[model samples]
Target: MSSVCVNQALTDDELRWVLTRLDSDKDKEVFGLVCKRWLHLQSTDRKKLAARAGPHMLRRLASRFTQIVELDLSQSISRSFYPGVTDSDLVVIAEGFKCLRVLNLHNCKGITDTGLASIGRCLSLLQFLDVSYCRKLSDKGLSAVAEGCHDLRTLHLAGCRFITDETLKSLAERCRTLEALGLQGCTNITDSGLAELVKGCRKIKTLDINKCSNVGDAGVSVVAEACASSLKTLKLLDCYKVGNESISSLAQFCKNLETLIIGGCRDISDESIILLADSCKDSLKNLRMDWCLNISDSSLSCILNQCKNLEALDVGCCEEVTDIAFQDLGSDNVLGLKVLKVSNCPKITVTGIGKLLEKCISLEYLDVRSLPHVTQVRCSEAGLEFPKSCKVNFSGSLTEPDVLL
Candidate 1:
């Protein structure tokens, strides 16, 4: 019986296919150094490139990967490096990578509106642009983008505090295909601007106005009502002025809403939660109300009873939540419940969490940190172990229970 050869040389296409399966960029880059042929193939096939190696490195990358589609300079230290890519570096990129679709310049503090204008002039095909935390950019730069990148779909202007209604109005008029907009921490934005944007861009699906304190119920309501049927994910974290009225409007109109995050909206209460659960019950998947001090057991009970498809729930720092909230949650109705974060709820005990776990069989992540009575040892002593699928986070300075004499 003849056996296949143990060491057969692979064709170039087969070799490239194997290399393409590598998950990390560093691993793939290492493979590129193996031989000139491998290096050429790797460079040609590379579509996404992340840089923190400064402007010179970016120029080198642009020369190598001519067909690059996405470039991220988030300065996140993916390779334990610093990002020195300034407006000059962006000019180099904008000049070279015209085919770019997604460009993330997160935390690139050196980039100014001048650089953004350059990007707007170039990269017409760009769809997703994230300049979050680029402090120097103002409405002037954003208007440039609106004028140039008419096809832009997803824009992240988070931390660009200088931007206001003008930018939103420009985006609304030009980028009609706009779908996702992230305005997190843009404190200057008010209701009028957001309302203008939503009215024109009714197709928007995801809107993150997290920490936009100036935006109140009147402005957000316009968005909820305009894009009601089309909106899917809405984040209003730390938007203090938003109250039950805006939430009710959202619940009533955004019938297709899937993810709703209103964390730190202190004014919101059970009325908002119940309205949301009742309106988007079937479609709701993730709901986060962290730091919402007014929420209680009644709200959780309402969610469990109505939003059967809910998977992720975070009611952390809600001091009012207690064991009573978990008692009815374990019913067969919420079988899909997987992640539950009740951390900082001082009133919850082991018994309550145990009851909750018993019902939420699908739960994989359980954060019960700061609870008084739910120590790891106590859990073990009680003959209760988080199943292989569950990971329970514990807090508090209490030592494990003392062994019996």
Candidate 2:
């Protein structure tokens, strides 16, 4: 025991092996703190990072995590005072991490077209980019990305008000492999842009035009027709211009649609919704028709009867939906339903919701808030009858502990 003394240190590869075994980021950080060599190795091996975005912080990150593939520089509401990541910071990011694939600058108000252009010029391998709520970003910035990142797959430009049809045209011309595109709150984007987009980018699978007020049936119909086989998730929430024609087109052509959110699309009638339920019954899982004033028992009954695989159903604010819709619910109907939201339905009482709970044994979430006929006392009484795992929202406000379960 006194004769043998092993002074050999673990090799870099061995240290990396150990680093890979660590599950938590805290454990990895502790490993890095063991020595400068370990820190360097950890930094080099790091492929993803989420940190506060600033010129100095980004520069340091770029220098340390040269191999980073995913970078989240999303600004939180609490940190609004700090000046966010800017064009110069992006330049540093582009130069440092050439292989960067996913970049999320969500809510980074300081990021403008110049910063995005820098990313486009350098990060050609970039695939998924989320610039959601970056109000300063216009078509000019995104067009540069479309031209450069040919393999771009998922791009979320939600709340980028300045983004117009020009960006769509650019994307259609260049990013043919684009699959998921989020144009939510891009009010400037209309049917013309969508038509042009689907013409070239027919591989698009998930499209979210939620709150794109100008987008109507013409644009959505084009998307349904062009990406009919590929389209899976279509969210048109608050797209007032979207009517029965769009839903009909989707039901007719896009048979594989999985998640369809027509919430706030008042123009959607029971006929179109029933058609949608009938057409996409097999594939449709999550269906949301919140604020679709015309949807009644007919549409609800049709959905419950047809969409057996339905997991999440939200008919909130649907003025016409009543207890009659739940009358025919059987043990087979919506068996897999996990989330049921019938909030603000003036006609739906606790009885209707209770009937739904009985049928939806797998129900995990039940939102019965704002039901004029259903009081908190009734909800509390009904809460005991709900599924064991179910969480009920009796009151409209989430903060109200008395009415929530």
Candidate 3:
């Protein structure tokens, strides 16, 4: 008198077909525990696996799925029970998966140079590796990666403070095909490393050097000179020492530049904006200059007039930007503008914003937070109607800034 006999009597072929129809790994895993017949089918077909388990569990998973190609041991809020996997564990895991191409070890605190070295030696075909927030990894571990994984195209080493010029120099020489590199919070990086990177990694397109305080005009100039033709996106958030020289260099040389962020670079003035508006007008799509206190209405006007293709613009905390800037910003030439953030700019009012919204037919998001006069009630009082395509964000509303520094 056993209950739930829906699948107990089915033939092996019928059971395998039902297991194959399951789209999620979790469901298939639960079914695998139903019986030995289901376990064999589920394990053999699995090619991707995401686990919060320690090395022992990872080894068990590898043994079950012989064809596994992608593995993620990154931290997750939902799976807090998994202990941080260690170096010896990585050595074991690396040997288990010969076809592993992508491995994400974000915030795996126990992993160090030794663990990464093991991965590099075993997984030569690894193309994407993210070790962001792994505090224990240093140059020694990265050097091992550079020596072995020549096919790596995207690498994220954000928050790894011990990485220096030597690590970058080594990567530039070995990972020549690398297109994206994230070094956010690697404050020790300076001109020497960037110079070496520009010389060797000419094909690099996206680079994030946010919070690398030591990177100044000297390093940025080299990037602009060497990778200008290929570099499409550049992030220099919190690089306080960067000034007009680096801005000018980018404007003059970076012909294909699309997204540019210099948030927290207080040294940037109206001149840099005008230069950028003039040089990268045709190519520039997104521009961010948060905390650029020196820029005023003139700079905004210059950008609006020239960068007609801009889809996203952020000038938050630019206190000098007044209502006058919005007059030209609403013109038909900037029809492509979809997202605009003017938060913390004390000078903008209901009149200015209403006018801008009326003309920006394609605008979908508007952030006017912290401006006193541009509230929802005030816009209604002014008899202004926003386009159906646009979502107006007023003071104290739910809107978030398009870019955060």
Candidate 4:
């Protein structure tokens, strides 16, 4: 007869939504006092209620939380807050989230090896884990992950400078199923460290060692030889120690390679790149030679002439490439080329870009930022009409961002 009793008798969907919308965990707890049925409803409604607020508010709602499929406590927690967060707090959380798959703890600067080890205890189903930018994590912590998690597919540790070659070598032995791994900016990872990873982790399809200054020709050669048949994507950006020989080795071995990024590898000349294009011309889907100062348009032109399967090309800051490079791609009947970045090349003008817009009609994104000739030359003199469908960000004519898409 009472209004409270009348409201309590509503449909399950309405009751669930109502209980979830009630703010404060204390208030959510209050619902249980109403009846056993209401207490049952609170159990299911609390997670949905926690999801309504943002990710950081979940810990407040659920104290005994565990068995999470994906845990992204990355932005909410930092490394400094680690080891001290309590094993009981986590064990209660991890017990329910036994199905935890993806864990992204990026920028958790306070988290030490102890807290990492605690989390690793419950990581049986974890697949993709990114602890990138977590500065405090060392070999001790990574050893825990490598030992605990079995089916890890992707592991990213970019900019985690504390991670040495030892951590990588250890992972190669334990995490055998690792398909995609990123060790970018791990400066201590040398040729020997890379050798262990190359020889031990044979199933790796994508490997990133960008800015790993210590990795030299020997390391690359080791990887090229060991994982030749398996490697499909390789990134060595800012790894200046390796020269033309390593590149050639990669070309010989990684024939099925679909993506190769060697940006900022100054020692690698145009010759090896051309050889790579000649050998694996049809297989390479994405090629990024950005900031490689020695590379000229001749090799690139040769690549464009032959490798018609190019999907994404980044020649940004390669000052040697002139309008000729763009011309080769322009109206050359090249199919499947969608994204192109030719920013900061002084020789390319609006005329070449204009002509190419018509040719690369399929292009969805084009960035030609800071091209002196393009910005300096008068639009009328260039004789190129800007197209509509493509989002072109140029130094001269492009001003607005496309909003419709």
Best by lDDT: 2
Q: Which residues of candidate 3, in runs, are more than 4 Å off?
A: 1-42, 77-83, 329-331, 389-391, 395-405
- Higher-lDDT candidate of 1 and 3: 3
| Model 4 bad stretches (over 4 Å) | 1-67, 76-96, 328-332, 396-405
How far out, in Å, is residue 358 in model 4? 4.3
- Pairs of residues at least 3 apart in sequence or in different chains that clash in candidate 3: none
lDDT agreement with native, every candidate: 0.84, 0.87, 0.85, 0.74
Candidate 3: tens digits of C-alpha lDDT, residues 230-263: 9888999989999989999999999788988898
Give the better candidate number (1 or 2) by lDDT.
2
Question: Of the pair 2 and 3, which is ahead by TM-score?
Answer: 2
Q: What are the clash counts of all predictions, listed in order?
A: 0, 0, 0, 16
Give the per-residue lDDT of model 2 (tens digit) for 145-243. 998899999999999999999999999999999999999889999999999998789999999998999999999999999999999999998899999
Q: Looking at model 4, how many pairs of residues clash?
A: 16
Better of 1 and 2 by TM-score: 2
RMSD over all Cα atoms, model 3: 4.2
Clashes of 2: 0
TM-score of 2: 0.93
Best by TM-score: 2
Steric clash pairs (candidate 1): none
Task: Write the number of the candidate with greater lDDT, choosing between 3 and 4.
Answer: 3
User: What stretches of model 1 exceed 4 Å from their correct place?
Assistant: 1-41, 53-57, 77-83, 329-331, 377-382, 396-405
